[model samples]
Target chain A: MAQKTIAGVNLEVTEDGYLENPSLWTEEIAKEIAKEEGIELTEKHFEVIKFIRENAEAGLTIRKVGKSGIVDIKGFYDLFPGGPLKISTKIAGIKKPASCV
Target chain B: MKKILILGAGTGGTIMANKLRKSLDREEWDITIVDKHKTHYYQPGFLFIPFGIYNKQDVIKPKANFIPAGVNLIYSDIDKVVAEENKVLLEGGKVLNYDFLIVATGTRVDPDETPGLKGELWHKEIFDFYTVEGALALQEYFETWKGGKLVMSIAELPFKCPVAPLEFVFLADEYFTKVGIRDKVDITYVTPLPGAFTKPKATKMLGALLEEKNIKVIPDFYLESVDNKEKKIKSYDGLEIPFDVLTIVPVNKGDDMVERSGMGDDLNFIPTDKHTLRSEKYENIFVLGDASNIPTSKAGSVVHFAAEVLFDNLLCAIKGRELRAKFDGHANCYIETGFGKGSLIDFNYETEPLPGTYPLPGIGPFGLLQNTKMNHYGKVIFRWIYWHMLLKGKELPVENHMSMAGKKKS
Candidate 1:
């Protein structure tokens, strides 16, 4: 665990830069994290992020997010650009999706 | 007499039947098992069939042969589990009520889920080794055909026997070389995972082996559809790879009955308690093996270890005691790396596969994460163990919970 300041809030984060405590996340923090990942936070992105944050406990997958009704898989790739699930979950203030062995 | 209904007489269900029947009296408890299929398949043997190492006869036996006497075996299709009524409706209008239920329906490959996967190329240029038909078909195809681009793609995540595809490629390397087509064959592994495997040390080790064998690894390629016209597979992210022969682990899902009963996730796996192995919704219903979304590899070893935990918990449930036995998602796999050499891995929910001796600290006949001939022998002899001991629920020397005694922290 490491401490990092995102949007003026000191928060604990994982080695891969995912938020350790999802509850500490704010919209400002998400935008700041998105900026670091070279993505501009759009309302549409936030909608997908909202879906991700809500369902993170249930387990998030690219297939699950594709069927989230907010976006198709192609649209998701366009929004996040690379490694959609990994990047989106980072910006969504959740831990990286496990490999689900 | 109270009834104990066990569904799907595969590895998990069969083990439960054997264990439960031995402990529970026949006069007080009626143990009944239901499965549509008559033949019990040694699923691990399927990996060898495509390479002509094992045949259909080697892997198959009558399901009734392993089922103990005094336990009822009903070979029929299950309609759905009416958990509320504690009864299951069979296809032929047979209603069986149960005091406790064991769900071990397992998982199956659904090629139809991916568009064009089940098209003209299916069972022709494309095959899956997960089934007897697919393995046999691939065997016939390999016998006549000259080698070209051979692509082994995993269509989805959390599929059964996570190491099987890696084993397939390793075996292919040896098989083709022996057939004098090693240079002509181009082997590529395509997977949705970011690397050759999920873990760090194991991935590094296996990735190096793949590199050494000249097999290409294509990571993070989430397959969307197969372009049958162009003989290419397209990813959801717009990447495409052409193939001469495509062997795929198609989308794996639990039995359709779980979906019909409204008790499964999107993949049809039951929502189960990872530790207790009980259904999240129904108290009397316990899930086992690949049928449950347990966040672990869906393999026979996992089923075997989990069956032990489930047996203890179910016994507790029957006696109106607290479910004390906890399954830690212990999974052990012997990876066939071809040419009479193999590797082994043992882990659980919290631990990743580490390098060391296994079952006995510093004195393993089988080495964990080390490619050796002894590990190959362990896998080779496992077929006998599976039939004679494992299905009978006879105690094996290995502990049900994963032990860290032998594994190195690094």
Candidate 2:
């Protein structure tokens, strides 16, 4: 059980740096996490982060996020580069999607 | 009762056993399938083992588990197939006659085919990810490995899962980055192909991916031999690439039995009709999977699609009816680009991989030729499907032929 502190808040995280309790997530914590991943948060990143947090329990996928009207397929890639859904959801404070390989 | 003998109880053999047993009347047909080994492997899972994504337990299962009821499962080494007399010779000199024979003895990576590949450095310095032993060995090596010049090469083309070498490099990039040593490592992908992949469209996109990751591409290098003493691989045209650790996809060839049986091409692959999957030399025999010399990417998806057509054509052959089911060389594979994202590609004999949605038009849950986490999930989910629905010979939702409904035609 590794713990990480972000934005003055402490939370449990997995070996891969994903939040164990996504409900502990906050906008300030999201900014800190994204900064750690070498991303500077913008309005475009927040749109995907907000969408994934709202639908986190629904097993949202990259295609679902791209089709959710927040972003297109290429737009999703442009925002997050490599891991759009996984990184976005992690920033939004959600359990890592099980379907992601 | 007529006897039907199927060689090699791998993916193709297992599916054929289940499909044929259900189609043929038990009173009139006796089904028997044979293989050299008893353990069935999810070969695509082999690619993930070195990356620590899958383990030995995840990829291995008993061959007897999926072998359907009413089919005689024989576990032994194959000696040769006597197509002239329609009989098979086992290693112990036992003989079994067959009314219909199916050869599915898939391809194997032969390190011996390449000079110095099996030398002293073999599994220690030089590793291959094609087999379980190779993959596990590489896993152990990479665990404590300090980063340096890591070179990945393909000794030849027409290997199993053509996209696998590219996937290996992609996953390597992600793995090293996670371990915080990405800057310390230099990755190079050396291939015999002109680009990253076989098709034109896929090569362009995948090649760009290699560049983006800073993995150098050394294309059109025909491997002459591995110089273990110098710690470098020499190409035929005298290009040498040095490596701290060398991973290779060795020369793949059909089973040695195909060569001794005298029913194969120069590489021991059986001459199979591109569309019909029937033996070019014999009418009562059929070839499927990596054993057939079909101009398609030899992957599990190809085997699954070919099985559908082969089952129909085999049934028609038994009834003395004109064979009609066409294979169309439909093959698809998911390219794992690591970081929990993957890409999907779908193509047949005629079409190249295009950018669009797949298995549906306009409103796809899975995108094709585009890297997405959904495609990555689709790739991982296939392992379960391979074990359950595919080996059981149940129909999948995807059609057996290629469709252009959602593709961008340019």
Candidate 3:
């Protein structure tokens, strides 16, 4: 089924991430979610990607990170100098771009 | 001439100092390790203290005994770390400069973070196992009380040894059982999280155990205020969890100096690279243990594993090379399930504690997700590992990385 609109969208996003191959889209979904969170891409996504991917089997949800969103984005920016897109995409299962090295 | 200054001669600082000392030649580098306290603690042993398994004498020894022979050890409280200047100011009127600094200063409990916790009921009706005084006092209270509403709780998240609360409950069950009042006492576990643990498998397993033990599990209860006058805990959601005796894992924060230095997250944890164990903000600084805001459980084992990766990365830093070594937040812990049995979980950033044998898949020893005596032995024997191997930064025969070896696969 297609995603429900508006209020239902957030709940549907969770099911969408859960039903999809999380290892494949953990980065993508996390990035898309970060978009909704009013944040841009940065190296910080790498940490959350690995954390979410590893925790997927144990149910570390984007909703959960959003709920406990005490994680400082600026702190993350400081943590990884790599751009968020590169970090998120890589942890999302993309190869490390040569420039990142 | 490069000068290296290490703050907090505790587990993290001592290990980093030892590791760096081995890498930096004495002729070219000068290393100084500092802390106000002379005694070092096997903090993991703090869990066993309440059960009368560990005493003050057993858990502490001289910090000087652990520092390497050549490294200079300074006994002083650090005022702050000036990252821009690459210097640390001590409690005295002395300023120490360094070419590079490692902030291995780990964390401790701040019961004051919550109102009335440290106020009236501290060490009386309310207690924490995170410290020696709290655990020892709780032990005395445990013996004195016949039985009442005993609530085991965590004030907030990000506590060291997340499994310690579960272990406390399991052992509390046996403690009540041994005291011959298991039937009289009521055990209720309250937490901010929605389950018995952060991991689902362990929660389902432990939730079932709580049922078997007749213990109540209250999930998603954020503590709003502690009513010491009434001896009850009020949640933001307005759900009240009442108790005759309260055991809490108070809110944990990174060392205060992290805040003073202006190099920490809101919770005062240093911002560190999750994979490389390098400080993302400052190239010269490296953080390990509870000092970093890494998502891994702030257990000693995570530090033990991160130490090796940090060791390799620091070498790269010295050579002006890229930090190639990666840390996956590998933390392995044994969850004691009471009686003579326990559960073992070995996992990394992406893996959960699956049902499998550990370190050697399909092996004869150390079963995962299942309770066994060998795992119980692993829990008890970790004391030896913490003292002789971990604090010294010695490599365990096991791989520094998490292995899928002994784990069972579907």
Per-candidate TM-score against the hidden true structure: 0.99, 0.80, 0.83
Query: Any runs in candidate 3 off by more than 4 Å, and if so which?
Result: A1-12, A16-101
lDDT for each candidate structure = 0.94, 0.87, 0.75
Candidate 1: list runs displaced more than 4 Å.
Answer: none
Question: CA lDDT of B160 in candidate 1?
Answer: 93
Question: Per-residue lDDT of B217-255 in model 3, one digit per residue for the tens?
Answer: 888665657898889998644578889999998988888
Candidate with maximal TM-score: 1
Q: For candidate 2, lDDT tens digit of each residue in B1-410?
A: 99999999999999999999998999999999999999999999999999899999999999999998899999999999998999999999989899999999999999997789889998898999999999999999999889999999988657899889999999999999998899999999998766787677788889888899999999867676899999999875567999989999998889999998998765678889889999988999999999998878888899999999999999899999999999988888899988988998999887889989988988777888888999899989999999999988898999889999899976
> Over the stretch A9-29, how does candidate 1's per-residue lDDT look in tens digits?
999999889998999999999
lDDT of 2: 0.87
Candidate 2 or 1, higher lDDT: 1
- What are the candidates' individual DockQ scores? 0.72, 0.01, 0.05
Instruction: Summarize candidate 2's per-residue lDDT along A1-101 as a digit string, tens digits.
Output: 79988898888999778889877888899999989878899998898898888887545655457567988656776787555666787788887654211
**Candidate order (TM-score):** 1, 3, 2
Q: How does candidate 1 fare on TM-score?
A: 0.99
Model 1 reproduced share of reference interface contacts: 0.53
Tens-digit lDDT track of model 3 for A1-101: 33423323332323322222233344455556555445565664565666544443322322233344544333433333323323343334433221100
Q: Compare the candidates by lDDT and give the number of the best one.
A: 1
